[model samples]
Target: MIGAALLVFGLTLVLLLSIHAAEARHPQADFAAPLSYREAQAVVVAAQAREAHLRTVVSQPLGSVNPELLPRMQTIYFPQTGHHLSNRSGFLDFWRANGQLQSFGYPLTEEIVEHGRIVQYFERARFELHAEYIGTPQQVQLGLLGREILEKQGVPPRLDEAQREGRYFPETGHTLWGRFRSFWERRDGMQLYGMPLSEVVEEDGRSVQYFERAKFIYFPEELPAVFRSLQHSYGYPLNALYEVQLSDLGRLLAEQRGINLAPVPQLEGTHTWHPALWERRVEISIGEQWLSAYEGDLLVFRAPVATGRDGFNTPVGDYAVYYKTPMQTMSGCMAGECWNVPHVPWAQYIVGGVALHGTYWHNNHGTGIRPSHGCINLRLEDAQWLYEWTSLGTPVKVRY
Candidate 1:
């Protein structure tokens, strides 16, 4: 009887040891085990609950939008997409500042948290919130969805050498050719899309190419029916069937993550929304030595300028930009003072012998140190931006 009881106890001990050894091999055995139908449902329900909580956290207004920009933050509803962009998040301003419809396309999802950062999705782009750059122009940045998508599929092998027929970027051993080349050159491709990562490849039965920041798909067929109707209704050219169209990577990635993209109603009690108030105009404050450029009511650019000193005051009146040149040799003699400067960059002649040009001679702007002869002087970059932003007959107003 004693031997029998000992044998039974030893067997039980060995069985328990075997079970522990199996568990040690697979540490996550409990978690890896096939869950029951009800357990799986519960897991999904918990995930959905977490997502709902995050959505609430992101949607609640943080009171972060600048008060001055509140007017421009008016909620905009896109009837075609059935989506509304709320101004509370300051996305509308960023969207408008950047190329709105042309660059980002329509909004795909409202502001949401992804990867511990607040973000929103547009049709072709993703907008990420950079709280570190808040109150600055770099507050909103574009996510690298193109690179991310390519990474998921494994990065393509780069070419050994750049091709000779088209624009070749030796940086990535990729060539931009054909319709893609035309589109890249026409649009601010380098700045907007970054470098091409791969040559054209077949993706989902379409000719597609990947860039560092964007994906382009060639659509040879006629414009979609909705776009055709928009072309007729809005008078904008929505017919780019022959051209390479940007893929809706933002929408695609959001869908892959099972994000909710249902359209929400327009927020109540917001200011009236306006579209494309592009009336390029410049205003100079002589007393403050400041210049402001406006597109309709939207203040696009502003900088300190060195106006004329006592006798050579920048004339306080309304003038139009009648002439522009990339570089000029400005030579003039006024009141016994003579200056013969060469290679003066970005000269936009607004008045007689008085132009808005960059000054490398002195940094005494925004103060009455050493002012200009009779013109307005600006920093090299500011002058360049203003030069590009203005055109012949752009209105310029000088005030005290």
Candidate 2:
């Protein structure tokens, strides 16, 4: 009788140990970032280990009899938690119709009736249904729950409607339109800008619009055909095009906002560059008085510069940084008079004798002051930075 009892105890102990080993090998499952198809499979597998009968049920396709769970709606069941969540009917349809995962994430709570409206919660969004069908596309709308919730938690709220709509530009008396309008819309209109803070105006001779998040300047010359349409739409006269085309308004606007939107690039800890690297180019905006370096489509560096004086217009066209010198003496002549500049630094020759170089001669690099003799002049430090960042044969584009 004693031996039989001991044998039973040993068998029970072995069974418990085996169960613990199995649990250690296959742990409980939870989604970290989000549930992908493969991740959902792993979660199901873990659940099956916990309940053998669940294997047969999991093998069957995840189906829903609910009419709302159609089109893009997907029903997901979590065996670990024994809870099911779904993108069903109204809220799911609204989310897909609007922005889906881009605007709002998957649902967190089931649809609940609140204040005579159906509501649901998502990771980053909240949805509410209205029968009146007054605003947005569908009867469903995104609640400003995030803003309200944050404000209750002592966080600052976003700008109000008055602040967002922005004032008009007193100089031009224009509003946003054309390429500027298109770019703004594409970049997420109200979400980014809230509203135009001011009317379209000229800060320092450039067409500009101030928004809550950013400032946009119009460059008509960059796209002439498009500008023609813009000019026609805005009813701008032919005479004003030249003045609007050449101004340092973007840089000045950025400075007023206290932001460095034109970020410089660094090559340290990067991969190698080849023949196509020289294909990178630089652009000098005569109106904005700004020079921008680009690697392919990416803007890498930007700085202020002084271009050629009145009569000696810095020829605007395509050129290349063909030659470079750390220090040199630049000499030129106009009619009967001759002039010489000595100890110039970081010279990168562009066209003929004209070059982009560092000027210790003056401190008015980006002050909209023109003091150079037909050469693009930079502050000493800016010149040095450009010298190190650029290479021979880099294309140069000078635009008005």
Candidate 3:
């Protein structure tokens, strides 16, 4: 009887140990046991989920027609607002996102399921939202005319519900986006682009009375969502310059200030530069003492600047504006400390980190003094002017 009891106890102990060992070896012991259905479903579901996310991320949100993409079926007739959406100006309420499967196509790779249950699911999309940019000024002009400008003269300037056809912006002086606003405030224009020259009464009778031509450029993500708000449309109005020669905002100001106006083809004597993305473009002429600004393909602004101790000889190379602090604590070998100077509402990334900005400490800007720590210095007003005149991405070229 004693031996029989012992044998039974030993058998029970062995069984329990074996069970514990098996449990430890199980892969899903930390969580739940994997169901046969779950394994299979996860494979397909995961693939579908990945596909959905990719298409969604690539496609533009369906708010307005993307001027560059093909119209999808989901983006059929726009704006069920009892108004016909024009294909030319692309007038519509919502430019629906084009994530819908254009046609039945096999996904590159989807989830692989080992069981019937869902491990993951992902659905691939065939097409994406159209990029509908209004490149031509004529088409854009007609669209703006269709949607009459709603001028809300309030504390915060805005253009409510005034849809942009190809492109639209109000003349607001508060900001630096003068290029678009320059076109929107025109008294008379055939089209914002491709318009022939015509006669017009100049505010300054001394300046040319002929109306300057117009131009339009299309960029997918040039402006941000906040700036695109209609309310801030009129905040950044044109300075003394934006009125006359709209395309080249600087020309209007130069003419108004009676500043020495360089002829349009200033490139005749010099090389006309075409800009590229993030190009290191700061042109410095030691002989002429001028600083030129370019934002990609456009020559935005140019001015004269003073360099270093004529000895440290400000290193000249193609550079971008890197650091833009409004009031910086400037320290140098010669100039002890410049406590405050209005520097950056805008500074382009050019070279390693140095940039061309304003100086309040030194009033004498163009007198040719070398009191700077390698950074080119401009007058406060000139600096402010340049600050408000460029995009953050503009290139500054400083070639000796």
- Go through the candidates in order and give the clash count of each: 0, 17, 64
lDDT of 3 at 227: 27
- State which candidate has the highest TM-score: 1
RMSD of 2: 26.1
The lDDT per prediction is: 0.66, 0.51, 0.33
User: Where's the lowest-lDDT run of ten residues in candidate 1?
Assistant: 26-35
Task: Tell me each candidate's TM-score.
Answer: 0.45, 0.33, 0.30
- Tens digits of per-residue lDDT, candidate 2, 21-67, equal 43233221110112333342344334323333333344333444344
Ranking by TM-score: 1, 2, 3
Q: Name the weakest run of 10 consecutive residues (lDDT summed) in model 2.
A: 26-35
Q: What lDDT does candidate 3 reach at residue 338?
A: 32
Ranking by lDDT: 1, 2, 3
> 227, model 1: CA deviation in Å?
22
In model 3, where is the ten-residue run with the lowest total lDDT? 96-105
User: What digit string (tens of lDDT, one per residue) describes model 3 on residues 288-326?
Assistant: 667665433334445657765544355554322333444
